[model samples]
Target: MEKKVQQYYRLKQKQKDIEKELAELRQDILNYCSEQETNETEIGRYKVKLVVQNRKEYDDAKLYETLSDPEVWRLLSKSDPAKVASLTKLNVISEDKIMHTYALKTVTLLQVDKK
Candidate 1:
C-alpha cells in the first residue's frame, strides 16, 4: 500500500510537470502568432488555426427562475408530464437541488506547432 501511494504521487508530479511544459509551449505559440499577426499558418503537414467562437449556453439561474414560477411550471408539467412525473417520483427536486451546466468561454487554438 505504501509503495503504491508513493508511485501515485510520483506519477501525479510527473503529470503536473508535463502539463506545465505544454502550457509554456502553448504560450510561446500564441506569442509567435501575435508577433506575426497571423491566424492561419502551415508547418509541414499540419495547419494551425486560431479562432474565436461563440458557444450556446443555457442560463441556469434564469431557467430555474422560469421553472419556479407557478404558471410556467404548470405549463412545463403539462407539456412534459413524464419528465415532471419522473423528477417528482425520484424526489430529486428540492430546495438543495443544484443543477450545473458548463458556462465557459473557451478559446481554441487548433493543431498547434505540429509537423
Candidate 2:
C-alpha cells in the first residue's frame, strides 16, 4: 500500500511536469502566431487557430437578484427555457446539498510525526 501511494505521488508529479511543458509549448505557438500577425495557419494537415474570447463579469449578488426575480425568470423561461431550467435546478439542488456531509479522500507521501 505504501509503495502504491509513493507511485501515485510520483505519477501525479510527472503528470504536472508534462502539463507544464505542454502549456509552455502552447504559449510558444501563440507567441509565434502573434509575431506573424496570423489568426490561423495550417502545417502538415494540422490547423492552428488563435481565438480571443471576451467576457463580462457582473456582481453575483445583483445577478442573482435579477435571475431570481419571478418576472425576470418568467421572461427567461419563455425565451431560453433550457438556460432558465438549468440555473433554477442547479440553485435548488445545490441548496439542498450539505457541504459538510461530503468527504474528500486523497493519498499523500508527506509524513508528519505526532508528539
Candidate 3:
C-alpha cells in the first residue's frame, strides 16, 4: 500500500510539471502571434528582431538583403545547422491574415521547456 501511494504521488508531481511546461509553451505561442500582429505604423522607427529557428531548408541568409530593400519585404532568415535542421523565413503579412498558406511550410513546434 505504501509503495503504491509513493508511485501515485510521483505520478502526480510529474503531471504537474508537464502541465506547467505546457502552459509556458502556450504563452510563448501567444506572445509570438501577438508580436506578429502588431501594427507596422505603431512600431515607430525601431527595428524588430526575430530569432527564427530553421534556415538551411529555406536558403534564407542569402535573401536577407532583398528583404531589407524598401520595395521588398524587410525580412531575414538565418539558421544554425547544429541547433536546427533548416532556416525559417519571417514573412510579414497583414493582421487580417496570420495563417500561412497551405503551400508555405508548416510551422514546427519546439519542445516545451521544463519549469
lDDT sort, best first = 1, 2, 3
Supply candidate 3's per-residue lDDT for 43: 28
For candidate 2, write residues 1-115 as lDDT tens digits. Answer: 9999999999999999999997787778777777888877765557777656432333334444545667654554432334544654767424233232223343212111232
Which of the two candidates, 1 or 2, achieves a greater lDDT against the reference?
1
lDDT of 1: 0.61
Top candidate when judged by TM-score against the true structure: 1
Q: Where is model 3 poorest over a 10-residue stretch in terms of lDDT? A: 94-103
How much lDDT does candidate 2 score?
0.55
TM-scores of the models, in the order given = 0.54, 0.52, 0.32
Candidate 1 per-residue lDDT, tens place, 1-115, comes to: 9999999999999999999999998788777777888888886787777886644243545445636767645544432434444554676443233233214355756465667
- Which wins on lDDT, candidate 1 or candidate 3? 1
Model 1 stretches with alpha carbons more than 4 Å out: 44-46, 56-59, 69-106, 113-115
Alpha-carbon deviation at 43 in model 2, angstroms: 3.6
TM-score of candidate 1 against the unseen true structure: 0.54
Better of 1 and 3 by TM-score: 1
Q: Which portions of model 3 miss their true places by more than 4 Å? A: 38-115
